[model samples]
Target: MSVLLESRVNGANLYRRGKVRDVYEAGGDKLVIVASDRLSAFDVVLPTPIPDKGKVLTKLSSFWFGKTEKIVPNHVITTDLRRFPKAFRDVRSLNGRAVLVKHCERINIECVARGYISGSAWTEYKALGTVAGETLPAALLESEQLPEPIFTPATKAESGHDQNITRAQLAGLIGTDLARELQRLTLELYRFAHDYAASKGLILADTKFEFGFHDGKLVVIDEVLTPDSSRYWDAEVYRPGAAPASFDKQYVRDFLVQSGWNKEPPAPPLPPEVVRGTSERYRECYRRLVGKALS
Candidate 1:
């Protein structure tokens, strides 16, 4: 909640602008990743700022990086803003929301791990009668829990939306061995974190993880378990028969769905109260998960 100037160093070349993040080539196999204030709901960024939302994501990612280091290597070089060169050091004052990470040739698949049925997994279950590439056992309800964790990989599109691909298709894209490794690691990481979150009174419904190759070694890159990349539900309200209240962007998405925006072209702006409520929910999630107040 500190007042800081919003600016970036001049030397870094802009890499790719994602829906919510801006990637910059920081020269010499390194990238400066910046999480923007943009809030996306129903595949569209709302036209209002959610205060401290970026900081909450950064904090959550940092926490998970530290927690999951034993599962896989990560690309984080430094989260301390002062360690950056003078030109880019000002970004530090913006709170520890930006990170300078070692850049690697990115894998084109979004590795998603789910322990519960919801979101696209629930939709797919209703449509194809299966989760990921495997068919579910008979008698699974809409929000029913999966028999076990599953790896649901999707193709990382260059622009627009990413397309979901089957395990066989993923094997074609990244070879059977590496594809299998991705699936294995993704579900293992999710299980570890999901159990940890449950103990803390939060439900980690699902999360998306990205990995890249660094010198023939696969390392987890980009953000890890931020609210934008994961769904969190209150454990007290989680029930098998009902869709539980979520702690992430579900607030914004629910509001947008009620607005009847068509989810295309010019998205409608969010009301001030909605922005404030959403921001508080993110903060609450971080505090409950990390067991510490944001610095």
Candidate 2:
């Protein structure tokens, strides 16, 4: 399988290189997003590119954007190659791995929703008996379902880790009214996606959403519920006290944690087996959630 570690579109002006997606400034208000096969673990982009990973991310995000559009407006312009400009359509490598979206001013907040106690939230709970400054009921085991989903927002850091902040701080940063509006949209989208995943025999442990303003209205932007942005667990094998089997990047994360490499730049290259395993897990997620194999 061919892998696009980096994109080189002929006519597009390259601007931003996100962890996974390459953002190119197309003419006017349009942006060409190329989802590279780059995999970022521990917030570090690994040297190896996973085969078909970028296609999976682009396809899965398109699948989800279709499902949740009624929940909120989104920045998607069109994924149809025929609809894209010639500069993008002429590049055959961009097929199924790129999207043209309307550019909008980002809200600069990571709106996260946790349906289960796990990940960084679990770490925070173990230390301070709270998740994001909100105290939780005592004796909650790891991976246990929260009494109810909580809207936890974090700073949208350009580099390194994003800091978990309180709702009050979120309001202070992005106005009280917009903060409340984003909180409402985030939880609604999460619950809707969570229930859908449950019916498909998967658990959406937690997920982060990004939003931006387009034409004076808040709209969902960037990637939606892909493996990189969400924690997906197998529902059949889920247990409250232990980490459940996941079909997301957890496979890569566990390997990196045990590989004895310091979590910093100059990250070690992933072994072939690790690369293949991670690729399969990402494909499995698209198959399960989208109900079809990635094209």
Candidate 3:
């Protein structure tokens, strides 16, 4: 299958090229977001591209934006290609992989919600009895659900890793009023998504969200609960004592860990089986959540 590692949209000014998505100025207070097939693990973009990955991310984010609109406003303008400007009318290559959204002044914070103890939280708890500086109950097993989901905010790093900050520290960075509002919205959205995923037979372990300001109002920006931004596990076989099989990019990360590759920019090429397996996992999550595969 063919994969698009980069997008070239005529008549639009290029904005930024992220680890997976390319942004462009689409004029009239709108921006175009194109999700590329490029995959990244451990803050490093891999050398290989997964087929249809971009379309899956775009569709899943749209599904979630529609699901959580009542909680807070978002930046999504429209995903319907037919309604796009005439300059992009012939760019059928972007049909399922691109979206036009309102341009907002993005808040430089990574709004993360954790419903379970795993990943960096588990690591931190093992040594410090804390997750993002919040004390957790002692003797909590790995992959165990927390007493309640918490809103853990992290700084938006430009080149290095994002450092986790406490609620107080978050308030210091973005002011108490905005901090309180974001914390409330983040937890509300997490609870709503967790309940929905449970009904679908999936466990949303954790997810990260980004927000921005539009005319003095907070609006959800960037990707929502897609696998790239979230951790998903099959509920049927989930256990608290060990890491469960997930629907996110953990499969690829596992392969890389076992390969003993240094988490650097010049990452190793993914094996054919690994690429194919990871592609299937992404598609499976989209099917389970959206009720259909990416067309």
Q: lDDT of each prediction vs. the true structure?
A: 0.81, 0.91, 0.91
Where in model 3 is the C-alpha error above 4 Å? none
Write model 3 residue lDDT over 1-295, tens digit each, in one string: 4589998878877899999999988888888899999998899999999988898899999999999999988999998878777766678778889898999999999999999999998999999999989999999999999999988899999777999999999999889999999999999999999999999999999999999988888899999999989999999999999999888778789999999998987999999998999889989999998887667
> Candidate 2 residues 31-119, lDDT tens each?
98999999898889999999999999898999999999999989999888778877778788889998899999998899999999998
Stretches of candidate 2 exceeding 4 Å from the true structure: none
- Local error of candidate 1 at residue 222 (angstroms): 0.8
What TM-score goes with each of the models?
A: 0.94, 0.98, 0.98
Task: Give the candidates in order of lDDT, highest first.
Answer: 2, 3, 1
Q: Report the C-alpha lDDT of model 1 over 52-97, residue by residue, as the tens digit.
A: 7778877789889999989999988887878754557765444567
Listed per candidate, the RMSD to the true structure in angstroms reads 1.9, 0.9, 1.0
Off by over 4 Å in 1: 2-7
Q: Candidate 3 versus the native: TM-score?
A: 0.98
The ten-residue window of minimal lDDT in model 1 covers: 1-10
